[model samples]
Target chain A: MASIKDVAKEAGVSVATVSRVMNNRGYISKETRRKVEKAMEAIDYHPNQIARALQRSQSYFIGIIVPDSNHPFFSDLIKYVEMRANEKNYKLLICNSLEDPEKEANYISMLRQNQVDGIIMCSHTMNIESYKKVTFPIVSFDRFISPNIPCVGSDNFRGGELATEHLIQSGCKRLLHISGPLDLDILSNRRRDAFVITCMKYGVAYDIIEGAHNKLTFDYFWSFITEKLSPEELHKYDGIFCSNDIVAYALYIYAQQQGLQVPEQLKIIGYDNHSFTRMLQNPKLTTIMQPSDRIGSMLTNTLIQMIEAEEDDPHVNNTTVDVTLIKGDTT
Target chain B: MASIKDVAKEAGVSVATVSRVMNNRGYISKETRRKVEKAMEAIDYHPNQIARALQRSQSYFIGIIVPDSNHPFFSDLIKYVEMRANEKNYKLLICNSLEDPEKEANYISMLRQNQVDGIIMCSHTMNIESYKKVTFPIVSFDRFISPNIPCVGSDNFRGGELATEHLIQSGCKRLLHISGPLDLDILSNRRRDAFVITCMKYGVAYDIIEGAHNKLTFDYFWSFITEKLSPEELHKYDGIFCSNDIVAYALYIYAQQQGLQVPEQLKIIGYDNHSFTRMLQNPKLTTIMQPSDRIGSMLTNTLIQMIEAEEDDPHVNNTTVDVTLIKGDTT
Candidate 1:
């Protein structure tokens, strides 16, 4: 609980001298600095971060807004974001927006009030106007909120192409693509577009099913897929490409429950090579690895740069990382 | 960007009056308060949280240290913790210790410097001396750092008992219990104790394989399990009880690769009933479910109470939540 004044008294120096030593500003004699350091150590004087951040107008805190941390994809994203943020001596204030626009807005305001160095927007529930009006630094993930804010994501179109090409190469004549709500106008819709374009180019019949966006509950999407694609309908497709690994996992479980053969009867490919993809039995999931770690590091570095940049400096450019197709037993 | 001075100038009030209105402290005229509120709205003024926190000697922030958020068990634990923390108007600064003592110590110091109201220690790489010296309030999860610190965790013994009893009832004469490193003296060791006692009571032969603590990489533990139990040895055991769902998942993958049947030829049970457990194919994993959400709420509330309580108040008692045996196709 010792303050700078206490350290100053112990060191037989003025409070201003102690402040200068703590901030490492202005000139100070070596003996005086050594005495102050010794006194600080003797009294266990830990400088208050709040006071220092107030002076510098920076909190060294980054806010990460995600829909749900329990979801496999978000879990990985959060893990990497925290890791990279920690590497730079920054702490992450992780807020789960729960896909609520109002909640996301409130969190953004909270982050601003605390003067966080920057915010990483992994959830896209808020409108573009809110982001445009934000005075603090913000870097979006997958979704481009406005031209002012930079976004970081993988090549979703290429990811879709890789997935569809893998399925077609496996001799799948009819394909099914299950994805998130395409009406959201998010970057991930590019995957669906690529899926359709690739299917048409290959002269293959394909159908698409769109589920609600940001719906973390797996059963909701599972029941939707089952209700829409019946046993007879499912029998028509020799391949299925899910938007993410979790959905593909649900599909794999559903197929197992139905006693349907994989690869031979239905080849499956998923996006986001999540850890659970390898845990599947009989046939492991073939997936598209979205370079999550790369994206996290890039996002963190970009946000930090934006935070440290001069007020009138130009914004950082958007980043698009590449994706890889990982072939497992499913294909 | 509007400071209190701007609000005061626009409201035609003294700076002290504006500060009083913002903090809701001291008596102020109703007309003056209304004018100040209107000024704040018109100027889009957000009172600096860092300055307010410094004045109040509180940050309203809780630090959470976990081994890895990507891990299924920790992900669920973190999601619930963040949700509960947010409900109480506390933001969570998530720190991934990566099971490194040095990293954990640095995070503790950083959290202290920031004047976090409390810290939730879910990763236990630090020594008792560190926890004892933490001047801020702290709550341990799944580990007892000191008698003075309140801990919140599920009943490991009961979880163990449930898994063992289910496997025995499934007609498994021989069983194997795979667990984390038992040398860490963590509360989870109680599960191993319960397993031994339960097996003795049923006169069932059981063996155990201890893996490194917090080693999230599945291949490392999988290789160890393979080294300990060869195919010939695995053939002798009709059931396996894993300490957690993640380890059970790795075991399931190994079993599938080895061409061993689940539930019929071999019954498997896991602890923690993670989301991936039910997502497993064929014999969905039957497992024990820890009351993670309840534990999270209890931990957050207790920490907030300790933070708000008088310094002379006695420490809160540790809490142990009940566990449930969720029956699935695995057993």
Candidate 2:
């Protein structure tokens, strides 16, 4: 059977373009659409799976498992994914696993039993063997679940490099990096790996703090950071990079309490420059901007393709989207 | 069949306690549980609907419609509701209508056709007549759909009175109130109404600016508020009330940009002390604390009862949770 890759090769365009053509997503020029269609015809692209989906009584439901929708990052992810799913006339079955391995496993089985058209795994807490046993069409966010299962996420390594390099260039000799828990071998861990590599390359002294964040209250974050930063220890680092914005805000508050003026005494950069940061954070937090909206759209589109095509051609979609550095008041 | 009210009376407890017993939610003294169970038995409380639900091939799906989960408030609500639903083994089907009436209507119909166990309507955009036509077991957040369908919400009028009173007590002669769009006759609008009443009672000057919020970006909020408060207009109000924390944050940013000191120069109060405000908000945003966690639990319990009973008894749940005043640096 001809794959989306075959269609892309025949169309003389990228797989994303071919997938876009197939999904009717984004602004595909008429010329490009026509070319993609012609290429599909020439390559005898596999019979339309949409028809098969309908014949099988498609549920029109896509299940998404995230660790916690309450976490700002995951909340944004859920919103974007839901928006895209809505656009495709699909509804999202949301599961917040709360980082429980059992809950994640249960959610996977429940999604399977429900016969959802496909599943999007944004929270990957289940064991690899458990994930591999899931026969449903699945795509993950930021985690490599299996070779055949697609993973969608931002270019975190690049994001880490940008944040670290920018902080270093901002005249910081010592740095602190705060990130989500490092136990999981997820793609986002690359951000930490890159942080270490970049710090070494730039000859900057850095310390790392990794903690499970989704379940912790902001009160916990405040007290914990306060405890970590003694009056003397507080001034140890001149710059900080947060894995996400909430932490950035926490540190910003911490610096204020310590009489450490932002940028003057401390410079902070957070990842995922959340929507609220644009206006809410005073002295905007300098951070890496993950395009959650695009990632969400692509995840939904990819899941739909996996469902329709029943094909596990991971290369059909370039799962990684670009991240950009946003200069805010903090740095 | 004995209604939950009947069981509550028999058990010498509130309906909420009976609901707690039935749903196995929250804390109930052993004596209370035993009393509730005995009352349920004596009163012949309707047969267990779990069995009926199973016999009918329960989808174990509860559809929740919000204008946009992207909004922080909705995101938090979604999180809490999803949490409770998960406790009960029900998965939430999330719909972000983006304040589109057509989308809301379509989602309602889709939910009905899918035979979801029930629906929690957090977004109310359709006509009341349309809502009355919905035969599905339905409960709403902050919007009264009809006389029979349950609506779960905070005591907005009380919330408003407290906020305005606090602002007035803080020695504010002039005040500004910011709220979500007033076009929809939703329960939250009572907050604005109470603001008006309280301000009038206090013999203080007040103004309200309402707009659709869920769909707008923080950038719009920043620029719009900036344009609203010109140099002369900025100094006009001594105190401001925001319908939600996001607007409060926006005004907070505005105050800082215009060099107006919070509390000292302009006291600001907002509603809905969201999960993030504990530490993320600087000087903290003095706001009304709407118990969203309790609200979510109540909403899920209400809908689950609606589904299990296949009955609509508006008095099954009290539906109104209390709000508290959280004093922060902003006020």
Candidate 3:
């Protein structure tokens, strides 16, 4: 509750002298600085940070915009980014867009208005053109927006191929692929395409079941799986590839409820080797590891580099981390 | 890249007039406002927020500190808080403490230095005394630090009683409870107490299994479950209550891998009805549903109320929401 004037009065010095010492902006003797420090400690005087930022012209904050934080993938990404940002002595502001473009745009403007140093966007709902008008630096994760902006992601195509080949090598004949909403050109779509091609190369029949677009709800996923896979059709498939582990785990539970034997009647695989896979009732999910933590750190490092680099430089390349298939009991 | 000088020239007004209009701090005629707007659009001008913030004392931003976003409970909480904060015309800065007291303390100082108006803390690692030095208004979630500060959480005792009574009614003879980190005295301990007392009432033998301390990691959980539950112990206990759904899922998978029949031989229940629970291999988790989204909104609303209240008379309260018991095949 102590103010600068109170500290100055206690130190027996002018308020300007105390201000100079606090801001480190003007010359002050060591004796005067010591007196001010003693006064501040005695009174438990904490400077008003809001007033300090006004003088510095920098908030020293960054914004992270995610589609949905509840999704394990984005949550893991946020953790890594926050860790890296902390290391660089920057505070992170998080905005959840919930896959709504209007919300995403609003957050972008809000971050700008709050004077954030830069923004890292994980939501693809907003238009790239809108971002072109932004004055601050932007780095996107798992999304390709503009040619000028940097993006970070895993090699989805290769990951898909590896998962499909693993299933085929395990003697899976007829396969089914469950994917996320198909509208966004996320790297995940590339994996889906590679999955189909890999299945075709092995002379296996494959079917695709598309979940509701951008609908990450559990109920929606359950309804989608039940409506797509009937009891008779379920018996015809020997392999199942899910876009993410959450869906694969759901499929596993639904299959068990229907009395179908796992790995014998159906082999299930998923993307994003989330912690949930290891905690499942069967621990039978075979999934592709997306290296979420590494991707998040790399993206933060890259964005920092971009912010520090000259604006006209064009040498930086988009980053794509590697992915590997994790074989589990389902395979 | 267009500056205020350029806009002023285009609008045939003085630079001071343009600045006043942009900040909305000074009187301006309707015609002048319209002219400035047209000039800004014509030149595609965007204000440099950093430069503008230097003129104002506050940054118009709030800080949010959480344990980890990857956890479904925290993710849902972050989403609701962000939504409510956005509606109130404030931007959110997010920090992940990773359940480390040092990291949590560091984030608090960083946010303070960055000039955030207030902070919403969901991390429970740091000591309550550490927060007394903070000058900004802080609202804690799920953890009570001091009587003077406002805290928000669900009715832990009631929820614990409901979960334990449900298990007892299911006719379980022997039970085991898996808990989160033990350092923080919050909902988990309350649940543990209720479980023991409820089991004692029925003359059922029960034991407590401390899964991990302070930090929840997959490696810690995997080893804890495997080491604590030997094949012999698995048959002795017919029911298990996990502090959180994540631990419950891990127990389910570990039990299944050891060839144990769930519900038939062993029943498992968890807290925090996360989306991942429905995605389990056998739907083998009956859990207590904590209203995470509601908690987030309620916390934000309370903080905003405190922030806007008269500085001389800040209000503080300890509020507890309700929790529901969700039934599933696991029990």
Candidate 4:
């Protein structure tokens, strides 16, 4: 009798790969599956106890991986994702990777073992190569992990353009853009691109500031901004555009401390019109409102589509939602 | 052999209850279990196929039910819960009940079917009776769901006392406490009780303003506050203690619009020293910080303890964590 090990050797792949193919689990390519099946048939391999639980039961579970659920943006994403998944009668298993790649890997393996139907990944702690190997259907939020994974996000470039243009129109001669880490290859970089291009087009004297890895909390952001830019230096720029509302809020606090009057001595615009931003009535935050509800809805729908689609179906598609400029007291 | 229906009829309970007892799934009391066992013996009932999955395997999945994860308080709770659960090698299944009892019921049923080991319930939409019927090990956060179910929350009364006393010491002549709906049977109502007691102790005149249903979002709160009190009337109270930081922030906005200096004209204190409140550096919120992280850890630990305990274990226990008055610029 041929053993599973013999079949793997015959297939020119690892034994674990053969086991994954046999169980119809994880991201085994069609070509790889065919090769494994061919090798099994050639070797006349038969398992003593074939656990078909992976393919037998539909868990109706979707795993959501986020960097940190407590973050305002991700919390909104989680809420909408849960709502949309509920609409489709799918339960969600939330994993907060906490910016740890090892934890994310463990979560992925756990989700697979529990037979989750799909995953909606928002965390970018893990490398692309790791995501490429996932067998379950996945759709990323605001990131391009691989061609095999679909990505959904708002128009970051347009958001940046709108904010910069609004500040320019508000009659600010000197401009400054505060952004997240621009080094990451995420789609959000388009926002920075638009910021530079729009500033160049308007020929405004502008400089850009970046956060440490673009993941600083509000307190850290406050300290970073204060440490990097002195009150006098910050006053040099009459208009500021923060990458997100969180950072913009830090800037607001800094401006208040510096006794710089908003929209008089300086004007500011933020991105991601989060719920907290709406409560700011001092000078209501004029922000680029990312369609968070719509983006969450779209991501869940895309994951569900991929989950329900046939294996031969086209696996990946990129979708971009529109963003709107909300004019508030800031501009 | 007697059928399952016969056993339930003899026990004077529903067939579903019998099934739950057989599977050891939800919150069947020791008395109820004994009654069911007696009925089975009396009727000579034999569970066909005896799907004794009760002692079979541990799912190591904990279900979390919350009204809205996007809410700052709940988001903080969820993050800490996830972190603690991860430390224990347990995965979380998050459900946004959306303030609907039906959705919560459905989620409970689904989680039971999926063999979740325990549940940490934060939503108040479901009635106490509904929670009492649950078969899984359960812990209620900030709500006293049932005497049999353990609850974990902060010392709301002490928190209220600290906030109120701080306001008095700050030399505010007249005081007002804006609280959540006082009619609900929730533990948080103690904050209101302490507020009244402390005000009376200090011989200070204070008024109480209640929100509708104890569930107001930022937008709803803004409208409620504006409609209920004119800016001129609001200035009458020299000190105000809001139920939560969200309302305090709205008050701050109101103060700015009305040209009332925070702490100088009106000393203000809020509860739930949430992250957003910390970011409000202009007049940083002097609020009572609910020990959210400690509460989350305690709740997870309590649930895990109950899950791992044997049938004869006296597992039910209520625990309250302490709250702190974080002095910010408002006071």
TM-score of each: 0.90, 0.81, 0.83, 0.81
Off by over 4 Å in 3: A1-58, A199-211, A229-236, A254-260, B1-57, B179-182, B199-206, B209-211, B214-216, B229-235, B253-261
Model 4 regions more than 4 Å off: A1-55, A214-216, B1-55, B213-216
Model 4 per-residue lDDT tens digits across residues A1-331: 6888998899999999999986557999999999998897687564422022223545678999998888778888888999999888788889988778889977887677567789999888788898897766999988998788999999999999999999999899999988877656688888888989999998988998875554526788888889988988998999999888878878887898799888788898999987667666666788999978999999999999998787746566899999999988776
Best by TM-score: 1
Model 2 misplacement above 4 A: A1-57, A310-318, B1-57, B310-318
Query: What TM-score does candidate 3 get on C-alpha atoms?
Result: 0.83
- Tell me which residue pairs clash in candidate 2: A284-A329
Q: How does chain B of model 1 score on TM-score?
A: 0.88
Error of 4 at A24 (Å): 24
iRMSD computed for candidate 4: 10.2
In terms of docking quality, how is candidate 4 classified? incorrect
CAPRI level of candidate 2: acceptable
lDDT per residue for candidate 3 within B195-222, as digits (tens), equals 8888888788889886575333555667
Q: Write the per-residue lDDT of candidate 2 for residues A88-134, one digit (tens) a residue.
A: 77878998888889888778766765667788887767778878866
DockQ of each: 0.62, 0.25, 0.45, 0.23
Task: Estimate every model's Cα lDDT from 0 to 1.
Answer: 0.84, 0.80, 0.79, 0.83
Lowest lDDT block of 10, candidate 4 chain A: A46-55
| lDDT per residue as tens, model 1, B264-296 | 888888888665554554556788998778888
Better of 2 and 4 by DockQ: 2
